[model samples]
Target chain A: MALNQTLSVQRLDDPAPDSPIIEISHLQKVFAQRKKAPLEAVTDFSLDVRRGEVLGLIGPSGCGKTTILRMVAGLDSPSSGSIVVDGKEVTGPGPERAMVFQDFALLPWQSALENVVFGMAATKLSREERVARARAELARVGLSGFEDHLPKALSGGMKQRVGLARALAVNPTVLLLDEPFGALDAQTKTLLQDDMSATLQEEGCTTLLVTHDMSEAVYLCDRIVVLTNRPARISQAFSIDIPRPRGERFRSTPEFTELVDQVWQELKAHVTLSNSQAVVEG
Target chain B: MSSSIRTAWVAFATFLLLLAGWWGVAAIAPSSYLPTPLAIFERLVYFVVEGGLLDDLVSTMINIAAGFFIAAALGIASGLIMGVSRLGRDTIGFFVDVFQSAPSAALVPIIVVILGFGREAMITIVVIFCYFIIAVSTAAGARSIESGLHDMSATFGASRWLFFRKVLVPGSMPMIIVGLRLAMARAFNGGILAELLISIRGFGGKMMYFGGAFDFASLYALIAVALVLTFASMAVISLVGRQLIRWT
Candidate 1:
């Protein structure tokens, strides 16, 4: 254990090229809800996200999928374990990794264009360049004409697109999406999923998405990592060997159903285990 | 433009009707206290045409402006501190309670005695009176920011400075504007109160002077001017706040 800790620390400290984009080992998160006993949100989680790979984390509700994603994104800290992204240990948030939140956390005061430009401002980009780049990104996200519209005025899908544009504007090496399209209508979710898959493919940036939707995971992910409920640990990792440019037909194929069933089986056991724990605790 | 003109016409009509009613009541009663619209208007015109009403008005305006700006600067700074930090919240919370409950009239004698009867005393009184409202409201606004937004920004890899610059400022603006509007009304009242008690050169001072000499017409005219200033300031605050709401 000491040797692993030393290796993890060394791996994090060095900014070498060959290191995985994200490495997490024996990660745990405990939340203390004032006066109540601490709840173990996540536990003994371990995973590696290779550069340019799209990794999906799938689990039932309360399975700590979002917690894992947040920890990877450096939004929250692990109780124990090391998280190294791009060969650097993430102690706090840095611009190297950008996130698209579940609720589409766009600045309501800023227009879509302004929101995108805001993300780019922390970098060395000039104001004019930021504007131009922001415009291009908005156009890429199919928001060319609605540049001046505020987040409140935009539809859920549109708002999510703006969130995506804002994250992409930073030109980060890793993109962390916490159910970026979870709140949208089914049609909107499908459209956004396609856009997201295409965007990641085009950018070739490492992605780690947390989702409950099995189809979304199979469609977009290079590998889907299933987790056991509460004190979550990786139960299985399934590599999707499907060809790219997946359409509606791909979603209905036998291959897709088999993968979904496989994930669902792992998920069912975890759900049962969590329910029994709740009953016992109660 | 046309709709605004209609609004102006409606407002003017309402004012004329109110003035007519006041005149009719005064004429019917012929009391020693109340003055007619014509009498008040004559005094107002006389002051505008030949007297030092402008100078008196400007002096009072200057006092209010100076005191208001000073209070605003200090109040906003203190409010931001109180709003942003735990220590500031605890320390300022006690002062806010004391100031909010303290009577404006009660402080006039103390302020005049300490600072002496002059523009400095008047301005000082106004600043003290207005600071608490602005600061308290601003602190409330700052404290009301959603913790989730902070978490999201942090996770997105935004720095502490960036989070403050981007989220905190924009988030607090609505509340700050509310504070500003509330503070403006208090500031105006403080200015007038200070002049009534401590200064010899403002509209409020003029009102007291005319009232003491049994010059009811001029006193009423000065009162009207004060009302106009208060309403106009309120209007400006409302317009600015509306614009901010629209932007968000």
Candidate 2:
């Protein structure tokens, strides 16, 4: 249950940072197959992620949350509609949006330090500058001592931390996290969520996190976006008002419980709808 | 040290057993078909002292080196291209199947006649023999690259050239090295066969010559040297592969 804590809002008079770092409009994505059924993964999904705001997307598995994120990240193209990031339509992958993949996706041949360095190299940073920046980013992710270790040698959490450091090193305007902490143990996940939230706040970067964990979304995000199952659409969005530096105690509040129930109820209805649709289609 | 000592003792016992078996067979048969172990050992020492085998061995080494280099260069380049592009993959894939399945050894006499027996002819044969193996391995290696790494590079704005140089090359290195090892073994066998039929300046030719002259001891000694060379090549490849895997 998410707390009913009135989601905090930026001062109305204060200008929003640079006008929607990511603006996705009516995006539709369909995965077509030959001699089989066609899959509509996302349908007319739209959202505006403003600068310096953490937007969490929570849905059941295969509800097209990942498809939305991938389209926004420019890893996949939308079948219809435009994705304008920083006012430019995205047709392919660009450095402006850096993604932290679910699996850490680090190059196996590279060490943690080298992975960070490679990410920073996109901006044409000098070799020394790249190294220094990589060290600083690794330290930021609490990986100061494991810089020289390969990804295979690290635990899943540590590897994801390396993935985080790699994305942060790029200094992108928007960060796309596709269930970045899904693979970690509960303790590690909680700790990493705190670390990631703190880092996103400090960096003042726009973020889109796709996750199945409702609590995680409620904890870290300024707003939560819910998507309906296959051929998913924006079912609803909720604002989370917990203050900065939100800690464990926040999860226990009456407000949090109210909001969590509200979102879960909506999600259950969507799931039922998905099942009926599946049965009919089958 | 203990393990090495144990290994040495085992090796010594094995050698003694082999020698005794050979001598026993020779004493009972008194056959011209087989030479005594002692006679072969003495002949080997004499050949080394007289440098009779050195020239032949050097010639074979040169041919193998030249052939292996050419095969490696062509194979790796073509393999990388085929692996990276769908069109290249489709085109070269068919050629690889043909070359891999065709009678490689059967082409030896034809190549010898066409090229006119010389160093070039031997090298051509060895190169043709090893190329398909190396190319197919390298191509398969490139194709087997993890999609995550490819996406990672693309997300980082890696240009095609940079991606190939930094990502694809390192990722495929281990498999490519394995391909090289396979090619080296093939080249060795091809080199020996080429020497036997077309040239008089390699160990293979010397072996044939000794056999014809009734110098069975020298022929056996040459066979032993060839075995040692093959083993040495395998050892070198393994050592190099271990170092490469560690560094990567």
Candidate 3:
């Protein structure tokens, strides 16, 4: 990164002060499909995301972490309760939030430049300003000179970079990621994780991530919250004590491994109980 | 070599083989009924230069083009509506299914009585045959876009127009083009039928005139021109479609 020398670490190895930018209270979601049993995804969930802190949501496969993330993005509604961003009650989608999807959700018809420009499409900014900002953001994400390439022509990593550029281009007050690197291969995910660490450090936006990987949560989040499967609740929350500017060396640190193991231990017991119960029912 | 060039060469080879086969068939059949390749070629040139038949061809094309554009506009609109709205799909979807398969020729006699024998009637007939196919294609195309994509757009606060223009139109394009190809092919077929049966005018009428006079060579020439136009349009469309959906 060209800005690496200028980049301040902005490390919060200590717990952040209670300056909550995003507040969720008694949030719940229930899916009612016709001709099928109702599925309760989340129940009695509440959390406050501190300003400039990366908060991670990790849970079992169907724990509704994505549902909670979507609700915060204002794409889904809570069956009951409220989500407030910057003290304004979020009813529907607003430009103050940007989401990075797991599937790379890039519109196939548009080129990377156009896709990145999509972020500012809802804004009142002049077209020239939008175009300039889009170019700058794509370049910031290391996607310079590949502006006109369509998502289909890009590799998985390149496509995700476009997604990242699209998200960060608008300069949203909140950053929401639903397994942003989940679809990438191990090598690519690792590389992206490092890049994301740098980007998140630089942007310093309030970040919320939903992931299945414990170590990934530990690596990226200042605080990681684990949820229970089906009718999800905050089972536990861990404050990651690992130092920032996370590099390859961070993965092997004792604190990092110990934290991951602790999360695994809790999640493992839950999974085993659920599996044995399913076997008995079957 | 590039795939497009390889395809062009293969197409050329196919045409050559078809011509050779036609010549062989003409040699086997009686001279009065089936004209030789050289005979058709000569008659084609004569019509182009002396008979003023290009005007008739142009007239037929104008009707086809009119019907095509109208159908494309309406079909895309209806398709997008159907794809997005469940109520719209439920209400009009049945009509789309029934009319798309209805023998296009049957509609001509009924339409002819109402609109009278003219270009308007023929254009209407062509549109009736074409629009349903295009609509069905686009609707299916629109439905195929994943829900995650829509969620992403909504999360980013995409306006309704932006969603339709950037998301729906482009997402459904691959199938929409396929539908266009099918609809255009039907347009030519419908145009020929309407012209042949309606008032004995345009390229279709010229074909009929040659046949009634027992001029096999000229009839073959007209058919050959029609065939060439059909293939040419399809080739151009496929090339454009390839360019549009390169990402997939």
Candidate 4:
């Protein structure tokens, strides 16, 4: 399409293909409370996401994994430290990154296609080009026939598909997924994981996925970073070392199981420690 | 279609029941005070056919429409500002709270003293009656938009104009429309009340003329006309609102 032709020639200042596209150094976030001591959420957390690689962040619930993702997406500011994306220091949200929320935050009043188009509002594309790109992205996510449906008319999985399509429609340099499939049922989750893996391979898009599900992290991520309890710090980092386009058969393999188990074992220690701490505090 | 037909039948049955109740009450009450349904119906026919009440009805409608449209414009604009800005909330929203709680009819005499008992005074009374409720409800609607949507808009790097047009306005529409429906009801009450108190004009004037002449049937007829007009306008607002937010 003419729109694709224009987009293909749009990226003139791209960095080296193998270089890190996003660098987060020594990030910290604190939540202030009235008449009480301020709470620390994330501290000394840092990571670099290489171009065209899927990185996963996993931890127990409320471990600030999503907080780190929001920081990278520029939806929230860090209390200290810095994030550089595409050779630019991030001060606020920009067109370089798009987030797929866990809640499938599609605008209830907009159709699936319009929601996708809304994401392209920051781009320099014309109205027709925006509509064309939106349609193409929606079709890419298997929502061609359902473009006119509102988010409420869609099931959980379909809604997330629209969310994914919206993120992808802007041709963002980095895609941020905050438990994108966490709200779906088990069966739908499995189906979407497979589709997501295939789509990531096809697009070769850089991604930072925040999820608590160990198996999901193992299946999709090239590298997994496990975080500790609140005031989250990186506790462990594991490389999947598995080949790309890993299929459903890989989920049954001993290698996948071993990798998932290893991550789970690392996460279980933090969970136990936080649970005991919670008991004491309560 | 079938459900709509059933709704119409139910409405017609209710109307008949209400008329029967009124007729029974009329029999026990003094005839001069509470006219029978048939007597009121005859007076209604007279008004429609030859009583020159049509001109009064048109003038009252004009006052109501002018007052309501002006109030709506100012209310929605100020309401949006109050909703999104802290300063606006503290200032405009503060007065909205005060006026909404106080009965607006209490201000009609003051309004007459200021605007001096005419169409302008009547319209000002209608504005005073309707504005506060619309502003209050619109502000509440604006405040109730989900935080996630705001975050989503920010992440997309939406411009302020785009955010207002696409997110803030549409997100707050359901409540804004609800406020409009309520304000419309108040508009009718205020317009008629102003006409009665400030000037001998409109349907209010006709009612006053009938009441002074002991024509209870004509007074009741005018009251029924007002009731029908209010219900019809409210239904129209509801229908338009439903069409606009079908996605919800």
Candidate 5:
């Protein structure tokens, strides 16, 4: 944890270290169903993500963490409130933000390289430049020879690699990940986590990661925010004291386990409470 | 044996079995309505060589081609419109649903009455038979495009035109191809039905002439030729469709 102390001192030295790259304020979302009552998914959720930092949102499944990420991505408009990225207020999806989905939403009809190139469609780059960038991004994600493979041909982890490459190809200021590794097997998830940690360090892009995995949150995020069950609100926030560029060996370390355990304890209480309340209400 | 070789062997065996079965039935049956395989083969040779069957086959194919292409253009355009817009879906999609469910073959008589007993009437019946089915399938394909892909397009700030061109159109292509294949079969049926009902022309006319003269072997031969042609055309469509959606 000595690295945490050094980073805090360094943060004090910087002119505006506290300034946020993404500010989400009073975000609310209610899904209106045709024959059922409107379901409130998020209420008054607020957070500020510092530049070049990984911020993780962890909660029970279906707790509106994904809704918040979607709202930030501008794929779903908030019922009320605002999201400001960099300096501009986000009215809809803009060039500055890109989202990596849980399902690795590569177009089934497109090759891996083409899927990456698609992310840059809104950019001012020429066709040659776009193709060049797409190839480079695919190479960066260790998919050099697999560029022509469709999504169905690729493994789950490989598909996510394409998803990550696509998001990064756009050169976004903020990256939104919605449970990116939730679908992968355990071994693949660990391997991806290691690669992701290294990649995030290299890219140094501000990222908002929504995941229910406590260990993943502790490993990848600088800060973790836990939310209550449906109509999610911030229940707890924890800062991981570990240094960056965490490796596979870090997963066995005492600090890593300690942070994960702490997040789990906070998260477990909420999950239990929500489960009991649901039983009673039903 | 290799899979392809095994498949070829099975197909060859099946053809032989079918021919033997048909021969057995023709030997037992009293009426000339069931012709022997050898008789039908001889008649097919005569028609192809000297009886002007080739000219009638070419003309019928032209009608089917023209009608299918026209149906495809109208179907795809309207289907895409219905897919993307609520107004389009409610208005045009409603009518498509109604017409698609109705017996399209029954409408051939009405079309013949309106356009009269001509090539125009035949083409009209073919178009009517095909248009609704293609439109219905295309709309379904467009509507069923993955919602995640839409989100991906939006997140990257893609323009409406760009999304339509790159994502919506390509995503709906598999369904469009499905629609086209089905429409091709319907076009053939319509072309034949129109020839039978409106006027004695094309292969349908040849069949009527053979049946009247009690040339049962020639009728069976013409029917076999038409079946072979239909199968060949369908295979061509499937090949083109496979090429279009190679990713799937």
Candidate 6:
């Protein structure tokens, strides 16, 4: 549900800061399976993400938004292009970048607090300090009383919250979230999105989010990049000029509605095209 | 009744019925071929107190312990190595399959020949029989760890030792314990078979000697002792195993 409170659009200077923290140039990804034709997921895609700004990537199914995020996170190697973070190219998954997986990949054997602590295990921080930080991190995620619960005991939303806390606990220079709220019900998704957005901004984290939800992109991202279907290239990138410290009422604002409508309209064509192609092939 | 109580009563009923059937058959059968239940019980007590049965029990228990211990250690170590290393798996996997399929029981005569028909040879046979099963099971457990978890570990920059301790050991524990249970059972078979085949001075050798001498009551007593030993050992191992892996 969107809040109906309407107010005139108050101007804010440059919705996102001008300083860029992540630079992607002509990035391409292709995967091969046995006896199958090589699948080209992305090609010739490029974008710059500003420091302390959330960037959302939206596209049709199989459009390779997650592949781009993984390359940036250093979990997957780029086929032909480079992802430079703070001027250094990413070689592999490193301590400076942490990923919040779509699957909520918390280790099953670990308690929520232990999962967060595990994220910082490789750091040179003292064990006592890591434990304290993990406690604070879990508290920040609204899981203060449930710190001892294992992933099997938690609901999907709670597990995801733990995933977010784990990434945050690492104090990464870059945060990569792949469909962070995709598995949740709409109500839980909205609430978590709001809480997580506020916490992320408060921490001044540089985030790259991949989502299929157009409204979610409008709600959270400072900029949204839409990609074409497979062999994905950036079709458009829009800067969201909505004021910061957005409230529930902001969702009902004409500007927010307009942005959401625009993104949906832009994305609808890609979805329709993919579906029609699939039908034709079948 | 609660399931545990029901299970206990069912087992008790089964034992009572089996004992009654044995007693009935023994009453009709010749004393030389099938001793009466009361006679077997008396002989069992006599053997335990006066006929050197306790010494054989101690000897058999020691051999089984040495064989099982060496099997468990070597099996787990080699299994982990084969699981973690591609070269180790490739070089050793073929031999493991061959050894597992070969039926080590048939090799007793060959083993006695090479090792000179003694306690050492019997121990070697048990180790061989036990380790094959344990190694295969351990390797399967280690190798079956999900690839996603491995990727998670790598992404989190976990060191090799940390990954092994936090991921491999705990993840494979339940499977390893199951393998140990099965290996211990097989160790009993191997140890007893070796003693019987080589005529060693242990429980199996005593059973063979009593059987050849028309001492049916003593033979029946020896079998009952073996049955009790098997159940007792398995129960002990399973109880210890449950304590170790209560998480699963």
Please report the candidate that would top lDDT against the real structure. Answer: 4
Q: Which residue pairs does candidate 3 place in steric collision?
A: none
Please report, in order, the local distance difference test score of every candidate based on alpha carbons: 0.81, 0.84, 0.86, 0.88, 0.87, 0.83
Point to the candidate with the largest DockQ: 5
Residue A249, candidate 1: Cα error in Å is 2.6
Runs off by more than 4 Å, candidate 1: A1-19, A268-282, B1-30, B36-39, B152-165
For candidate 1, report its TM-score: 0.85
- The runs of at least 3 residues in candidate 2 whose Cα sits more than 4 Å from the true structure, single-residue gaps closed, are A1-18, A252-258, A269-282, B1-31, B34-36, B214-216
- Looking at candidate 4 chain B, the ten consecutive residues that score lowest on lDDT are B26-35
TM-score of each: 0.85, 0.89, 0.90, 0.93, 0.92, 0.88
How good is model 2 by TM-score? 0.89
Candidates, DockQ: 0.32, 0.45, 0.62, 0.65, 0.69, 0.45
lDDT score of residue B20 within candidate 4: 93
Q: What tens digits encode model 2's per-residue C-alpha lDDT throughout A116-206?
A: 8888656878989999999999999899999999888899999999999999898998899999999889999988988887888799888
Pick the winner on TM-score between candidates 1 and 4. 4
Quote the positional error of residue A166 for candidate 1 in Å.
2.0
Query: lDDT by residue for model 4 over B133-219, one digit each (tens)?
Result: 788888888999888888899999889999899888898899999999999999999889888888888889988888899888889
For residues B173-221, write the lDDT of model 5, one tens digit per residue: 9999989988888888888877877789887887888989999999889
Estimate, for each residue in A66-172, the C-alpha lDDT of model 1 and write its tens digit. Answer: 99888887778999999998889989878888888888877788899988887774578798998999999899999999999999899999999998998898898
- In model 3, state the lDDT of residue B228: 84
Whichever of 1 and 6 has more DockQ, that candidate is: 6
Candidate 4 wrong stretches, greater than 4 Å: A1-18, A276-282, B1-12, B28-30
Q: List model 3 lDDT by residue over B28-105, tens digit each.
A: 884787788899899988987896897899999999989988999999889888899998798767788777778878
Displacement of residue A222 (Cα, Å) in model 5 is 1.2
lDDT of 3 by residue, A1-282 (tens): 322322223232333477799989899999999998888999999888999889899888777899999999998889999999989998988888999999999988789999988877788889899889889988988889999998878889999999999999888899999999999999999889989988998999999999999988888888788777767888777776555658767888776677688778767865666567567857
Better of 4 and 6 by lDDT: 4
